[model samples]
Target chain A: MSDALPGSLVGPVEIVGAGLIGTSIALACRRAGLEVLLTDSSDDHLRTASGLGAGRATTPDDRPQLVVVAVPPDHLGAQIARALAGGAVVTDVGSVKVGPLAAVAGVPGVERYVGGHPMAGSERSGPLAASSALFDGRPWAVTPHPGSTPEAVALVEALALLCGAVPVRLTPDEHDLAVARTSHLPHLLAALAAGALADAPADHLALSGQGVRDVTRVAAGDPALYGQIVAANAHAVGALLTGVRERLDAVIEALAGGDRAGVEAVLSEGVSGTRAIPGKHGGPTRPTGTVFVAVPDHPGELARLFADAGASEVNIEDVRIDHDPGRPVGLVELTVDEDRAEHLLTSLESKGWVTHR
Target chain B: MSDALPGSLVGPVEIVGAGLIGTSIALACRRAGLEVLLTDSSDDHLRTASGLGAGRATTPDDRPQLVVVAVPPDHLGAQIARALAGGAVVTDVGSVKVGPLAAVAGVPGVERYVGGHPMAGSERSGPLAASSALFDGRPWAVTPHPGSTPEAVALVEALALLCGAVPVRLTPDEHDLAVARTSHLPHLLAALAAGALADAPADHLALSGQGVRDVTRVAAGDPALYGQIVAANAHAVGALLTGVRERLDAVIEALAGGDRAGVEAVLSEGVSGTRAIPGKHGGPTRPTGTVFVAVPDHPGELARLFADAGASEVNIEDVRIDHDPGRPVGLVELTVDEDRAEHLLTSLESKGWVTHR
Candidate 1:
């Protein structure tokens, strides 16, 4: 439990909507040795969640210390309001915070309500995809509205910690704006970039490489679900999109007029932006070097290469495999600390691997 | 050598630059048992290429049968013109073919000139990054103009084969347009998206996820170099950017008007675009499934995981690792043929490894 809370959570925790998030939370709470009551509009989902040992069915006799509402955006306000009517400290796991917070602002016992958004998810949905470890080491935004009580906010933060996530406190508006900049805007850009390829000729498509693939990877997500998410944060996303439009116009004019300096300025800003992202472990970014090695494509080849790489005792920060369509060999790029790159390269070369830094 | 050519290249290939591409071509030619003569304006680069055994220094007495111009875009025209003066079957490895082809159009013996662009590269430049396997199984676009002789085009195609690249024939203008749609446009979009993050608050950036990281990866490339590449194909790229801008405006308008259907239409188009990309082996895309496993953040953990995975005898298509910053565990996603996913999951679980499909 968070120290800011007056006391530890001893529950009967009620979780509404036994979907991916709800079931996962139920599993986590059960793992923490708390009693959990689960419910969902879908009987099949509720049955599956219970069968997976997430929790038992809720009853009118049960009095929960905490109520977690994890449902779709359209039903969130109603579900949260209904949960709060049970006179329990309540929180809802929704991507956007302000709308839901506004929905229940005038409800009775509004001070008991808080908003949270877990920074973890998958392309697949439903209770079948739920895991107790889903939120392990992820960021869970604890968004408190002006009407939220201090104890309610602390309890929400404690729930985040109980699920093995780090709780980041913010006002509801700030959380919405932050996710709008980081998540919604990037997704919109990916979709826009990928949409250009829809009508391209086959010859043009043949020229595709890793760059286009990376930029459009996330655009393969479900359209309706993403539409709901983006629409919910329209105010923040619209502002960012407008700013991007201005930059796009600038680039268009620059290219039209052969203004090389203008193009470079935009590219240079991108470089700085990449640098601004925090590195692994939520720390400052560190300089890294890449070593490329050719690996034969087979069942055990990657295992052998990884074993050999492991023998060198270098911590690989990241790995990328570039498969050659016309050959049996794939190029594997391993990223490591800059200072130790030379050592890893020499070690791999000594082991008869064809490596290049 | 391509059968389209009259005969195979015997010896005495002249390379007009000692940079990454030139030296790599030189090494590939040498590996094929041909004599390579290398030259560069910088004596240091020439000495280094020679010392690395990529090729020997060029001399006036060396009468080469082929000349490969691999200089920067600024010097490509002059060098290709100079190479043609030696009365050899001439080709230049540059990204944009139309510009260089136009530069040498008026030169005498223009029938001997062909344009080639191998779709393989690295961020690092210079002779030190040269490798014989750099072009292995990659596409090499052979752009022949109206005046190019059959023998000259065939010889250029043979050069592509010698470097282990698949030759795809197209007109010079078509090649430019292809790359403009596939490569240049995606790069510009990535830069535009990343540029928006340059002035963002640190708090906002802390909410970053893998989606943002993948989308912005290529935006970290050298600004000046990318500026030149994009500028060279500005006509095609500009047209694509205009299309993208219209779509962006539509999305903004859709959001402002609360039109969820409009937003979803754009996203649905992006989904279709991703589906249109050719799968591995340049074949039709096949259905694939991913199995997720928890891995400890240690040196040999990957080796052990891969070794275990190989025991199932299922071919892995791709791998992605999602590291949890606050924990020692990283989630590794292994993509494989869809039908094999269940077998792999069962096998991994039997081996006492926790896995999910």
Candidate 2:
């Protein structure tokens, strides 16, 4: 495992939590040839992480060069302060930044702390769910307060790099507000939208399609956890929700009055909004066209189709498979660069695949 | 070609509006051994449909046993009335039901008409986008007013079956309200959620992940067209939106006030709402466990993994591939029945696959 690690990662690092993020970070650090020490308030969590090859218990003689605090938001500030007391370059992996930074502002050795959050996770939690590859290619936010030393910030950025993540730097306030709009608010709205289905007749819900499923997927996450995340960033999330409410009210009123233009404006806004999300690797969102190929529901069929696309020199940007229940065929939609879509369709057709635009 | 079609379909089926749904229906009918007569206001569309082997142009002497009016919502009333005047068992594939039904209630021969909406579509439109397999195993709602004769309703049901779709019967009012909650409301909310991203800073959106993408996927649909669908069902949609707004306000206020319990309620509600959506084949949602297999970023690797899983006697319920940009590997998450997850993981691992929880 250490063979794959970067040479820049220093050993003897201390992780203050053994939860999902903490254990995953430890595993990444361990894979990066760093000596990790795992600790958590619960002995079960600590043992689980240690057994998973994340790290062993810290010894008194092991003076760490870096300390990572990965705890719940409510306890993050205190944990950061505790880690900073060890005189190591301290950082955190909390979801929200500004609140915790402010709470630790007056603590001793505050300059040794840099706030960080990796924008990568799954619905699962706990040490058992940890994986070394969790942070790979993900965006990790590093927010440093003015009182922090440049050395501390650099150390945190280096750690993120060692984990194969792209570190994005922003001020604490900016980071909180940005995440409020991009992450927290979206989660909340997903929950809100999904919550509406609770009382719907079962027969109606049986007709739900991919549209509703995709829209509400994140709402199925743990409620208490999401509540805490939103609560931690309440001010920013609340402000954004207010804006959404105002816009929604207008849409509702327009819809109630049957105003076509008014409804169009709102719907158009959605188009522009979705278009703003960057494509793969943070590139500008490309206009991609889809080629729908009907693939027989067999294991090797999808592989053959993709192989054929690859042979044609068409790069597939994204793929979605729509499997009709009880059917032996699936619609495999391949999203490719718009300019190459026609070529791909013709190529696939010539190869005996049924293609639909 | 006719061998692929069912024998129940009669000859000389008339289809109005050679657009996406209309053209697709024509292709399905032609595949079902029927003599299809295609018509459209736009000559270009008619030609395109004909070029695609949907059907030949209709002549005055070409009488129809069944008539399908797959036109825009606003024009559906007139189109359906005209089709009904031909003395055929007429049906429509409009998105909305009650409004069009009410509009054509006074038309002569209205008793021959039944309102229908096929729960199948794509973002693309026009005759070139038609597919004969578009409706396979999907639900097609058939709504009839009290005046609808049993024979007329049976013909519409037969049409749905011939297209390989399950026909679900509902009163016009019930169909309108059910679709308002299941289809129309979800579409509008997706648009509203996506619209929220329009003014966000570019850098903020650069970090967006699959969560945001899934939530806003439907928002990328044609705005003018969606506006019309929402407008036609404005009354029902407006009422649903109003409820959403009310719940949203409560959640926002709770977040602003740091009311953890209140926020939890909203989040938990989302969990329940999403759970109400039936899984594959309209079955209760199964609790699935995922095993993450790291596959190299190359064609045929996914096929190998699925083949491996199939060999293990595990049926994969769903799959999602998370590709790390510029990385040599992608993580393929396979969801299977909870009981079989551990066995699958071990089997894959023994087969030299890198498995994660």
Candidate 3:
């Protein structure tokens, strides 16, 4: 009962599923001081999500102010229709908006339903991994059909705002193409990279680096959901793959002939052009702020080593410990203040701490 | 000049072609208190390198103990042959070792030649960009053929040591495959990603994000240089591309009609498989430290802003600036000592610093 957040701000949200996305939406809504009702086909998932404090389960006597339909693209229209018929201002969260919108458009009083998708997620799946802050400061698209009411659109926008998401306006086709380039294409590329190494000897793969990990990060996404998503939007994805294939073909041709100039030109183009792409939250993706350190082994040594950092009031945003068991040392990635990094290293070394430059 | 780095090291060296690699090698050699005779086809290039204290120009009278052939891949074999004819122990710093090694293998008295490719570089080209620290702590692969003199191999490794670079022995084929997977394929991928926007209007391209920029960063490399490298390693690169294409096809198919379980399984495989990849210095890459700061557009802001971090007594390692020109504020990426970051940010904010969740 934080009065600072109004009734409109504190949602009466009913999530129709308790899978990853559904649980995440519930978690986020609850965090914002909302009353969330979560229902799902799987009672086990509901229990898990509930244990995570996503929201308290509710009965039908509580009329939801907004209903978010989080289900498979195939089953999405039905869920939205059910929410609307159940007398709730409804929205559906699905990858492809057009198909579901088209299917449900003929439904009487379709304006009660608005289409939305939060374009931020992780490879982690299931209700067990639902995050209350998953929707924080990310893009959320709302697709409203011609018959959609202004109140419906406004309500959807309010949900996005409350969830700390940026609202983007686009036609169904525009949204499709944009995601095809950004979201869907990256997933395809990552999957392709991952699939190539599926059968590789484990030892060879251990030698892989950040580049491959980065290129294939998205490949870890849920294939079934992705399949259902891509099928609904095959034309856009197919077109993108065709472009990738053409470029790859040109690269192959240049390599076959040992044409140094041709190969370099293509590579150069990629470097220059990619710079223009914005980073998350519409920021330039600038590279900075990482110091890789190699350290020596000793059970109590790491704890003591970090003590100095603790004394200094530094915060490590991320850490990676890569140590071969037999080796007497390890490599640690310490994300720290760039300006103070040189001084920290100097101080650490002065304290008899070993470091990899 | 500083005395020798207290390590048992070798002497007067000759470096051919004072480009980025050659000049950088010269600088490293000179830093180790070894006299180096640097040669290049362009006197201007040689002078620039010499100005950077890389090395002095060589005279015919200089019979160097070690000779480094830092020419283009296509020109390396001929150059190594000439250097060997001069009775100098030689090595070529070319991206493709097998091709050049084959081209010069039968040259008279070829035992003195060792083939090398330093697996580290930047997109920028030219001798002016050379730095002694360029190869420090990076991998430098040395491929000594059967006929290579043991002394030559040792000398090449000694050079790598002087540059503070680790010496990795890769068979020509292993080396080819590694570069193709880690370096070449990434370039192609990045290029294709970047080039996709080539057809996009400039304004639309301006909205590119971090993911796209990251995937495309390597695309800005020199086209001519890449062409030579790719042409030389056609088979390896071609195989990698084919692998990429197959994987991509699978992803597309899965996304089109696959279920959530299927897609998530595929994505999970990628994360687990890729997390095993080693980082640049042979460790896994991790998220660097991070600090979220609310920065406003004000005069003398950055300096005063970071001054608050002084309380934590930790130096910054890297900095990222994210600003929206239209907005009055921005977010700064401050990477610092991991342990100190939390206390520092807290102290900074307590001093009236602007920050947000």
What does candidate 2's lDDT look like per residue over A18-64, in tens digits?
98899999999999888999879999999999999999987666678
Residue B167's lDDT within candidate 2 is 84
Q: After superposition, how far is residue A259 of candidate 3 from its true place, in Å?
A: 5.2
Best by TM-score: 1
Categorize the docking of model 1: medium
Q: Which stretches of candidate 2 lie over 4 Å from their true place?
A: A1-8, A294-313, A323-329, A342-355, B1-8, B293-313, B323-329, B347-355
Q: Name the 10 consecutive residues with the lowest summed lDDT in model 3 chain B.
A: B1-10
DockQ of each candidate, alpha-carbon based: 0.68, 0.55, 0.20
lDDT of 1 by residue, B1-357 (tens): 123336367657899899999999998999999899998999999998998888898888887888999998878889999989888889999989888888888999889999999998877799988888788877899998999988888888989999988888889999998888778877878887788888888777777777888888899999998899888888888988999899999999999999999999999988988887766667777988888887777788888888989889998887877645566777787888999988988898898876765
Q: Residue A251 of model 2: what lDDT?
A: 87
Superior by lDDT: candidate 1 or candidate 2: 1
Q: By DockQ, rank the candidates, best first.
A: 1, 2, 3
Better of 1 and 3 by lDDT: 1
Candidate 3 overall Cα lDDT vs. reference?
0.67
Off by over 4 Å in 1: A1-7, B1-7
Of 2 and 3, the candidate ranking higher by lDDT:
2
Top of the candidates by lDDT: 1
